[model samples]
Target: MKEFIYCWKDLEPISHIPSYVSLTFIACVLTCVGFLYYATNTLSGEKNNAPVITTTFVAIWLFIITILSLQGFFLDFDFRPPKLFIFLGILMLIIIGLFAFPRTRAIIAQMPITTLTYLHIVRVPVEIVLWWLFIHGAVAESMTFQGVNYDILSGISAPFAGLFLVGMKSKSKLAAIIWNVLTLGLLVNIVSRAIQATPYFHNPLMDAQPNIAVFYFPYVLLPLFVVPVVFFCHIASFYQLIFIKEEEE
Candidate 1:
């Protein structure tokens, strides 16, 4: 493990951010990563050993992001396009590649729709963390339910949508499809709001608060890992409901 020396700039924010919020966000991060591993392992099966490789790769990617964040690499707001945008773009391309490649698409398709549906429950904690961040001045109200973001609804309804599939015995994929589409729209809404709130593209009309908290360590994981995973879950859910045939439960 490489040693990271923390400077005063990196250490100052720790005193302001509440412990509970940090712990809760950390838990959500673990859950999201663990859930993805479970879903990947379930679909890949023991024969392929894909889970080990995929999870290892994800872990390494996250470690690099975490290190950079702790070093304040993303805190520079003067850079055009922003470091956050660059990393997020990379993540978007990776997601697209997962769905575009035949072999990877096949593996992703095998993920149980029910599992994908419930995986969103992690978002509930995410919203809470955002709300807390707002209270502490780390993020803007526009990113929380009190403002423009309505993503909490998606997290709250995830279980019901998953249960709807179970209750209907997979007889209808329409309910899940509608839910996924609506929730995906919600995801896009907040993500757009977040992007606009970035320091480089701060929109005064949107809210007085700027979304800079994510440029810090731990919180940086929100964009680097949590949001992307949730986005992928919604996309995966859509792919399963629409393109793949649903077998009776």
Candidate 2:
């Protein structure tokens, strides 16, 4: 274990921003944008409105992330726990507010359940990126499928679940509900392990090398942008399942 940690620590990055890292970061950002476009387009019920809203939201989100990166917010490990909680709290508030507003609730209800399921397929690539980061020794093994992170299973199953939800003329609401619940559990599991592995969490088990890659530029986008998007996707799926009764029609 000591040798493993020593080796990981010794493998320093050649540059702060390498080519593969840049490509992965760009891919992540584009995935977020694509999902936002699909969501706003589906909810707005008008092509023009969808593009406008999608563009606005994507711009604002990107701007916020850029500012955070420029300010080196994610690099501050000492104060990360509080900052992470604050960030997640703000996101949760926004989600709750969207669902609370009647108009937004109606819009959310109109979002296709299959598309929501398909959105989760992005997790497969995300897990792949996590593995890559692990290879570079940027993160702890606990954050990847090689260790405690099993969230990749959901990503693996998402497409089939999505197709099942869509192709079945008489969709099984119970099956969809069960799948969402199980995937949500998987998400929670990885998120909890990630938090525990962070330096701020003071987990002695990972003291030799904590999950610090997420606290840097480009990679920071994972927690700030991608994770929340995934969380919202799951919530949106549940919301559609519970509130929208397709069988009644």
Q: What are the clashing pairs of model 1? A: none
Encode model 1's per-residue lDDT on 1-249: one tens digit a residue: 011112323445446888899999999998987888888778644586667877897899889999998887886655667788899889988988898889888888887767777888888989999999998877889999989899999989988887765334543577777887899999999988888886656666877767778888788888888888888988887787788865522
- Using TM-score, give the best candidate's number: 1
Q: What's the C-alpha lDDT at position 61 in model 2?
A: 70
Writing each residue's lDDT as its tens digit, candidate 2 over 176-221 gives 8899899889888878877776655636556345776775567767
> How well does model 2 score by local distance difference test?
0.71
Candidate 2 deviant stretches above 4 angstroms: 1-18, 43-51, 78-81, 166-170, 247-249
**lDDT, candidate 2, residue 235?**
85
> Which ten-residue region of model 1 has the weakest summed lDDT?
1-10
Error at 245, model 2, angstroms: 1.6
Best by lDDT: 1
Backbone clashes, each candidate: 0, 0
